[model samples]
Target: MIINQSIITDIKNIIVQSKEKAIRAVDHQRTLMYWHIGKRIFEEEQEGKERADYGTYLIKLLSEQLQPEFGSGFSPRQLERYRQFYRVFPIASALRTQLSWTQYKLLLSVDNEEQRDFYIAETIKNNWTSRQLERQIYSNLYERLLVSNDKENVLSVAKNEKFPSDAKEIIKDPMYLEFLGLKRETSYYEKDLENAIITHLQEFLLELGNGFSFVARQKRIHIEGDEFFADLVFYNRLLQCFVIIEIKTHKLTHQDIGQLQMYVNYYDRMEKLPHETPTIGILLCADKNDAVVKFTLPENQKQIIASQYKLYLPTEQQLLEEVNKELESFEEK
Candidate 1:
C-alpha cells in the first residue's frame, strides 16, 4: 500500500500543537482556580473579621483541609501566596491568562503597584518567562529606569500608552552586562567586550532597550584619511533609527565621545535613509563622568549618548545610592 509520509508529518504537527494548546489551557484554568480559592478564603476571612486571629485561623484551617484532598499543593505557604496574588490583582479582569502562576507569584513579590504594573506590562509585551521577570525584578530594572526618567513616562512607554519621542525614554544609563559572564576583577579589551556581547546578544538586546535588532559587529567605515570600525551596529525599529555603539574598557574621555560622534555623523550622512531618523551613537564604557559627556557633545545633543556598563548587579544599598547620585546629577543640569 502506498502511504504519504507528508500525512504523517502533518498529523504529528497537529498532535504537538493540540497538546501545547491543551497544556496552556490547563495552566490558565489552574491559575483561575487559585484565584477563586484566594477570593473565597478572603471573603470568609472578612466575614470572620471580628474574631481574633480569624484570618490566620481561616488560612490554616483551609490549608489543612485542602492538603488532604488535593495534596501538598495547597500547603499553608502556598495558600498564603495565592491569597496574596488575589489581593494584588483584586480585579478579576486584571488577571492575564497569558501569565502562568509562577509569573504571578513573582509579580506578587513586587510591593509597589507602579513597579508591579510595569513588570506585568513588560512581561506580556516582551512575552517574558517567569525567569526573565525574576531577573528584571532582582536586577532592579524598574528603579534603575526611574533614576533617569519619570515614573509615569516610563510606565506609559512600557504600557504602549504613548510612543517614545526621545531616545532617553528607551535607552538606559549604566546598562547591566553581568549576563555576559565577565568577572569584575578581569580586565577586558574593547574587542573582548564586543565578542562577549555578541555571544550573549539576546540578553544584551533585552538590556539595551526596546525594538533593538543587531545589524553588525566591527562594522567597518571609510573616511578620507582613516578607517573606523563600529563595535556594534543596531537598528531600533520603534525609533526608526540606526544605533552605533562603541565600547570603551576604561572611563570615557572627550576623545571617545568625539569618536562616537564621528560614527553617528557618518551613519546619519551616508547610511541612513532620508525617511529614517538621524543615527544615534552610544559610547558604552566601563565608567563615565557625566560632566565630560555633557561638555563633549553639542548643546542641543540628542543623538550621542555616553552610557556606563557594570560587570555585576548592584546590591540594594548600592542601587539606592546609584539612583540617588543619578537623580542628583540630572537635577544639576
Candidate 2:
C-alpha cells in the first residue's frame, strides 16, 4: 500500500485545526470560570454588609481553602484581581470571549477607566497577545497618544469608531525606540538608527501606532540630475496615504523640515495614486522645538510633522510633564 502525500497533508491540517479549536474552547471556559469566581466573591462580600472591614480577610480565607483544593491559581492576589475584574466589568456579557484570564488580569492593572477601555478595545481589535498588551501598557501607549490627540479622538480611534484622518492623529511624539536596543548615550549616525529600525521593523511599526505598513528603505527618487533618498516609507491604510519618514540623530531644524517637505511633495506628485490622500512626511529626530516646527511650516500646513524620538521610555512623571508642555504650546497657539 502506497501512502499519498496529499492524504497525509489533509490529516495534519485537520489535527492542527482541532488542536487550535480545543485550546480556544479551554481558554474561553477558563475566562468564564474566573469571571464567575469574581462575581461570587463580590456577591458574598456584599451579602456580609461589612465588606470594607472584612473583605480582605474573606479573600484570604477563600484563597487558603481554594488553593489547597484546586491549586495555586486561587491565591489571595488572584482573588483580589478577580474582585477588581468583577468591579471593572460588572456585567459578564461585557467580557470579551477572545481574551484569556491572563489578559483580563493585566487589564485589571490599568487604573484609569477610560484608558483601560481603550486598551481593552485595542487589544481585541488588534488581536494582541498578553505580552503585547503588557508591553503597550508599560510603554504608556495610551498616554502617548493622549499627548498628541484629545481624549475623545484617542478613545474613538482605539475603539475603531473613528479612523485617523490626519498624520497628527496617528503619530506619537517622542516615539519610544527602546525595543531597538539602542543605547541613549551612544553616538550613532542616521544610517545606524535607520538600520536598527529596519532590523526591528515589526516592533517599529507597533510603536508607530496602528495602520502603518512598511513600504521601503532608502527609497530613491530621481529629480533633474540629482538623486534623493527617503530614509523610510510607509503607507497608512486608515489615512489612505503614503507616510515618508526622515530620521535625524540630532535636533530638528527648519532645513530638516524643509527637506521632508520636499520629500512629501515628491511622493504626493510622483508616488501617490490619484485616489489616495496627500502624502504625509515625518521628521523623526532626537529633539524638536515645537516653535521651530510651527514657524517653519505654513499656518495651513497639514501634511508634514516633526516629532522627537526617544531611545528609552520616559517615566510617567516625565510623560505628564511632556503632556503639560504640549498643552501649554497649544494654548499659546
- Give the best candidate by lDDT: 1
Give per-residue CA lDDT, model 1, range 1-333, as digits (tens).
999999999999999999988887899889998999889888888899999999889889988888999999899998988788788889877788888888888888899999999998999999888888888998888887887689999999999998887787888887989999999999899889998999999899989878899999889999997889898999999899999999999999999999888889899889999889889898999999988887887797799988889999899899889889888987877
In model 1, state the lDDT of residue 273.
97
Q: How high is the CA lDDT of each candidate model? A: 0.89, 0.88
All-Cα superposition RMSD per candidate: 2.1, 2.0
Pairs clashing in candidate 1? none
**Model 1, global lDDT:** 0.89
In order, how many clashes per candidate?
A: 0, 0
Query: Per-residue alpha-carbon lDDT of model 2 for 1-333, expressed as tens digits?
Result: 888899999999999999988887898888878888989998988898654667888899999999999998899998988888788888888877778778888888798999988898888888888988888898888877766678899989888998888788878887889998989999999999999999999889888988889999999989989999999999999999999999999988999999999999988888899899999998999988888998999997889888889899888798888878877776666
